[model samples]
Target: MSWRFVSLPPQDGYHMVTSFVSVADYVSRGGRNTLLVFSVKEPFVNVGVHQEVWLEVDLDYTSKAGIPVVRRDLGGGTVVITRGEHDYFVVVNQDEAPSDPKALYAKYLSPVVEVLRDYGLNAQLKDQDIVVNGKKISGNGAMTHGKAVVLAGNILMKLDVDLMSKCIRVPTEKFRDKMAKDMSEWLTSLERELGYVPPREELDKKLKASFERNLGIKFEDSSLTSEEIEEWERLAREKMEEEWIYYKDRRHPELRTERCVKISSSVAICHVDYKARKLLRITAKFLGGKLAEVSISGDFFVMSPKGFIELLEERLTNLSPEDIPKEIDRVFEEKKPTIFGFTADDLKKAFLEIVNKPEVREVI
Candidate 1:
């Protein structure tokens, strides 16, 4: 059967990528082999299945940084992606790929591993992760959409270690410094390792060659059909909405902390706590578009909790209501954690409701 290879414009957020996945799901339901490749404009923190955004990120810090937080339907550790990273999503009917999930990952990733080797990166597939020098460089996840299985991952061609460390919330006292160093040692970028950046087109070509060689298939370059494009736009809009981006589900508030920020919006509530040193609890309520409440909690150590809260409050006062989510996302992006399963949007909604309640609105 002929395979369709469609390259899409760079999508900046999880919602857009997931929208494309919806299109792939539709195509795969019709028994087509679909490969979608796209890039993103900004960096975003993506959580895996069975992970909570609050548990994995430092909301207090992230809300101030303007980073975007997202939760993927697939399962894996949380990952940070910026413009320097390249991502791929492949959707194939079950009959088109191996039935066994493990086998399917191997079959699909063989090409990526080969391509990395050709670039002299010494890339190898270990278990379900793609490793370079025994450190994970690429991680892939698979999910079933209709009758098709979708495989998606990113190649960290170049990443900002300091920024990544600052973007995620981690547990150790020196976690930020340690992660910056560890990531530098564990991950390699084509630009850093080769001392020059490869053109995007060239990289795509190399990946295509590797895919053809390993999968024994020919790919025909194509564009999305009108039907697919229409569907994509519709889905993208829905994904970007508050309902999908935040408050998709509700659960008991698990973690809590207290933080303060100095912003025009007034004393916005800020809460943050840690687990294993990573962000575990994050709640921020805005008062008059300012932070009114900030709480942090979890099974993590925090020396001078009062000091941390005061610092956050000062920062919150400086932030605008619109900046809240970005700030929260930045904290999570810098601080990496195991993640519990809640999403940033989930916490955001809770905080928003708590802080932004209408003058006439009342909590039950």
Candidate 2:
């Protein structure tokens, strides 16, 4: 199907996020047209839908700097965006895209990978992000809102590591310093990697061409429909309210404490204490590239047969780290179990934290 490419003028934080929801709404109601929106917005910080605003952002600094802090309806951590950064939103019917989270990310981001490769970067989709030389160049996520499937993220042109670190409220100055240093080493931008950043118009042309080639679909330039504009305005107003910006879902800290240690090349152990609706603590040992054992303990309420957590833990054993998310999905689907305050994604995220332990890669 042909897609509509909408290049919106630079907007505020509220409009930038609301546009995606509005487009999703438009597509959900028999609108055959898919959409690709490029959001050029002012500097601001946007937290994940599930994250705590107080824990992630410095409200005083943002308020003083006139930088808005908004929450997006997506999972992941906070991100800072500004004029030089390029944020793209791909809106299509859920059926039009792959259903698997990993597959869906690759399907939408393959074109982006191609674009980066053309610029002489050895870019690949690692986990959920596009990375070059083991450093992230693009970050993306996918979500299903009703019938519309949205994959959105930013292509880094340049990043202010110091500013980003300053805006976040970490537990200590030492931790904040470490975070800033890590970000400088772990994040890459077009200008930093290539020594020059292409103009927005040039990047747009290359991106459009890549999408057309990779997806085998053509796009026509278009403006927002009356319906879409109405929806955008309504969503903007609603999302801009203080209630939504300061929203909190977890009854406790999302990730309270996490630690991982490597014993040998083929053996490692990890412990993660996290909270969603309640609280969960995971202790896992990995051996020979598989989960040798796992334990789940917390204050979470599970409405299932006794020992359901044991069943879940047993199922997780002997599985490859990369396959945990799929296994969790299967267990939930087949068991039809109800885990209060936490969804399958939350479980998957917590489990991946163990898989992504630093020691897991040091051996390789």
Candidate 3:
């Protein structure tokens, strides 16, 4: 079988390329060996197939900044990508690939490592990540579609590290200034590692050579067939839809939130510890909601759970008399939870009724 190399121009093109490659590989009976590599414009938060977007992201921040949130069909931790990141996707027949996942990475990413080495950077595969000097520069994930396995990853040519940190919601107190400094020191970009910005075409050529040498296959430059192009457009449109990006699972409610106040979702009941400023303990009673349970144990810290309750009280004081469902829908839209079978508005109304009065303010 001959290998086909298709270079997709950088755009909202990653999803399209993957879909087309999967279709071609399946329809052609593994006869079409293809490499689909593309880049995307604007930063997007791509989550795993099973991840909850709200739990994985700070939606308030992402929405205000105009960043798009995408739930990919693959499984992995959430990844932030921008125009600078170089993305690679490979579609191979499972029959041709070794059964072990590590072997798959070795087969595809070994070429990437070779290309980085050619550029004077010591790049090696560590598990599934491509690391340069022990800091991860690339992360890879894969999923099976029909008879094909699609492996995709991005090379950190240049990353906006600060924006990436902000885009993904990590408990801020966990990383002190000194710890943050130490963490930043570990990350290395291609420009930083190579001492200069390499031309895009040059980088692509290096990758092409690496694959050819490592895989013992020749790559012929090819364009998408008419059927493939049509498929790509259809997939792209589907990806761009809000419903697909936001709520593919029917079990996920429209919105949910975690505050200092005592709030119960259909799945879990949360009680925050005021002194700890984090979740004291969460009891998950149902499985339909995305989050099972969360423990604020160990060294994790946040605004006192009591403080969060006070904030909720203040925010909901004027709405105590409002209709329940209307309030729930409004709050759900505002907070946008991935758990809590009910909406944010519903939680607010329920909490107010449970307390029987607004919470008193206490100075922290």
In order of TM-score, best first, we have 2, 3, 1
lDDT (10s digit) by residue, model 1, range 1-66: 577777877786755457546756576659458667778877777665334455666666667888
Q: Would you estimate the TM-scores of all the predictions?
A: 0.67, 0.72, 0.68
Give the best candidate by lDDT. Answer: 2
CA-only RMSD, every prediction = 12.9, 10.2, 12.4
**Residue 138 lDDT in model 1?**
80
Clashes of each: 70, 0, 8
RMSD of 2: 10.2
C-alpha lDDT of all candidate models, in order: 0.62, 0.77, 0.59
lDDT of 2: 0.77
**Model 3 poorest ten-residue lDDT run:** 296-305
TM-score of 1: 0.67
- Model 2, span 231-259: residue lDDT tens: 89988898888788765523323322346
Q: TM-score of model 2 relative to the true fold?
A: 0.72
**Candidates sorted on lDDT, descending:** 2, 1, 3
Predicted candidate 3: what Cα RMSD to the true structure? 12.4
